[model samples]
Target: MTDTLETQPLDRAPATPEDLFAFLDAHGIRTTTVSHPPLFTVEDSKALRGELPGGHCKNLFLKDKKNRLWLVVALEDTAVDLKTLDRRIGSARLSFGRPELLWETLGVRPGAVTPFSVLNDREHLVTVVLERAMTAHELLNYHPLINDRTTAIRSADLLRFLRATGHEPEIVDLGPPSGS
Candidate 1:
């Protein structure tokens, strides 16, 4: 599938953080952002985020055996076992997608992956999966397509934004880590 935004020129540059915020505003998805030290891992976020409240998330850009791309967003603490996640999500084997594919499909690099990047995926080439537990929180947090800032939005607004981008995300109960 040609995974390019239909409304934008093929030569258009990847969306920037500013573009992401503008798109969110255009959609009326209320959000709040805070700038902080660049965070490259969940541990970095925990150390620097001090008092931010919400279900902070980790986004995994994955590719299935069939070459299908997936964006799995789960709580920062969720122990996502790739060995077993495929069965629950109805896919063949799953592996982390490469950085090139991530940039091509979602317009973000590792350490900055966010569901918000789906705005660049106008063709719906990526399957978004939200952890059921994460959605139970009143608010969710993720990078605004960058690692130096975090943005919080209501869980419902997240669903609204994803749908507005033509990605009907799959909310799956990924369950406790194996041997819990």
Candidate 2:
């Protein structure tokens, strides 16, 4: 008898932004996707920053006791004290969103959280919080709805994605860097 061969079918659909460049292209949104080993933290994002093009961001999801969800996007190098951010965002206390909440709300993992995930926010329940300083930059980068890959996109195009996703973002001043 001939040897039998077994292959594993893809466990997950190639629906995430990383796997679907055509989605953005269809919308006339041009971007560059770069594959990195895997980065879980901003410091980690920083490590691979040189290899990637465009500015990077750190994303945070917070909730108020009332069950209100907030998405915070900030410059990767900026130091934000969540304790202080709590007041700015008008929340009880700012903390990382539970893994379940992340999946439920954005259909993403803890380390893979990105504003792009907002596409899955069907209810439009999450309010985006952006750093006012971001407007000064022409481009911003983040995971492509998946951490395995990073996408460098025009800041304007990102806004287009948010709008198409039905997300209204709030811009706030982050004051100054921790020591500054």
Q: Name the candidate that leads on lDDT.
A: 1
- lDDT for model 2 comes to 0.74
- Tens digits of per-residue lDDT for model 1, 1-180: 333321234245779989988988999988999999899999999999989989988999998888788999998878999999999999989999888788777778789999999988876889999999999999999999989999999999999999999999999998874356
How many clashes does the backbone of model 2 have? 0
Candidate 1 residue spans exceeding 4 A from truth = 1-11, 177-180
Candidate 1 worst ten-residue window by lDDT = 1-10
RMSD in Å for all candidates: 3.4, 9.4
Compared with the true structure, all predictions reach lDDT values of: 0.88, 0.74
Say which candidate scores most in TM-score.
Answer: 1
Cα error, residue 1 of model 2, in Å, equals 61
User: How well is each residue in 73-122 modelled by candidate 2, as lDDT tens digits?
Assistant: 98876688877887886766666767777676777788888888887777
